[model samples]
Target: MVTYTGDVTPGGAPDVRDAGGLRITKVAVDEKMSNNCYLLRCRTSGAQVLVDAAAEPDTLLPLIGEAGLTTVVTTHQHWDHHRALKAVVDATGAEVAAGFPDADAITEQTGVEVTRPVRQGDVVRVGEVSLEVITIAGHTPGSIALLYDDPEGHPHLFTGDSLFPGGVGNTFGDEAAFIQLIDEVETKVFQRLPDETWFYPGHGGDSTLGAERPHLAEWRARGW
Candidate 1:
């Protein structure tokens, strides 16, 4: 009995639910209070990927187990993003993964082994889906996104904190380096994807490449 909720944001898009085939369920945890987390599900195989567990395991662990999640992947080493990471790892014995840069910190915090150290061009096979990893280091020195060709739709890009609906993510690392990384993501990743490709961000409601692509120029012009 998966219940659906309406959009609560002022100008945000309505909540979406995929009832069949490959699906993605948004579990708004501390994110609405601070940051957001998502659970990516493959209906065909009943396997899931937990992205950015921002709350306690008691809050999200049940959902993860219910969804039959197999892997936990972090967008970065930000504390808010991995709040329940250790718990999730202990509960499901799920393999934890993160970008290469934050491998050590993630390892320390979770105390759970990192099964895979992802980088650009690397693919993580989740059930039958292959998510091509895209390293976008801006908000954090180790931020990464997932890009995949969906079997049901055009394509999908799970942009951790690298992108959002209105603008790019925060520049917390080296300001100059972060800006350069933003530029790279805009050019190499976003621009390469089809216009209709979906952008599932880490902190906001979903937006399409067409909706976000035009805004990139504006973001760059404003020195984002």
Candidate 2:
């Protein structure tokens, strides 16, 4: 397997990687916004689940192809994360899923009803692979992360705007919110998962738990 750098640029070809049972394709879209949209396809069943249809249905629909998307999961209620949500769902007739707390806001913003209002423990299946929903709120009321404990290998996490490469996501200067988000991530993610676990963020390159573990205190103290 070639190294999956997780580096993508707008209008560039996607970065694809195989995670044991599934394949993850990270596509950067939306011009200057450069938001990332992930396409998770189950190797066996060919069923696909897209994470954060941020923009450019023109780019995303082609990736979906004829097999079509089974589900479109919006990481949070952020406008930058779901710009092409309505269009993608409309094109593929895919089911919409988002954190339970932010479902209403997503529906209101995109005019797409969240058929699956997933909570922390919800399991979202994409073909043969099952992703456990981990609600890491505070960045947004419904910000969530998806964990696929790849049975054949190490774990893979899809941490939307909440958890990123350098630190937890931007809380918009809300100290209390930052604390809440960090605490949730530390307890639910850092403490529970091993160091080898690789995580994919909504934007930019990915990182492993081991690489970011030592900076927990720095992030907490810095408070951004």
**Best prediction by lDDT:** 2
Expressed as tens digits, the lDDT of each residue in 1-224 for candidate 2 is 56889999998999999998899999999778788889999999999999999999999999999989999999999989888998999999999999999999999998899999999899999998999999998999899999999998999999998888889999999989999999999999999999999999988889999999999999998996
In angstroms, the error of model 1 at 213 is 1.5
TM accuracy, model 1 = 0.86
lDDT of 1 by residue, 1-224 (tens): 54554232412322446733556666556534545566777767878888777675776776666555678889888777787887887778788789999878878876766778888888776677777888887677788888768766678788877888888877754668657777878776776888888777766577788877777778876766
Each prediction's total of clashing residue pairs, residues at least 3 apart in sequence or on different chains, is 2, 0
Each prediction's TM-score against the native? Answer: 0.86, 0.98
Q: What ranges in model 1 sit over 4 Å off?
A: 1-16
lDDT value for model 1: 0.73
Q: Cα lDDT of all candidates, in order? A: 0.73, 0.93
Cα lDDT for residue 176, candidate 2: 92
- Model 2 pairs whose backbones collide: none
Off by over 4 Å in 2: none
Model 2 Cα shift for residue 217 (angstroms): 0.4
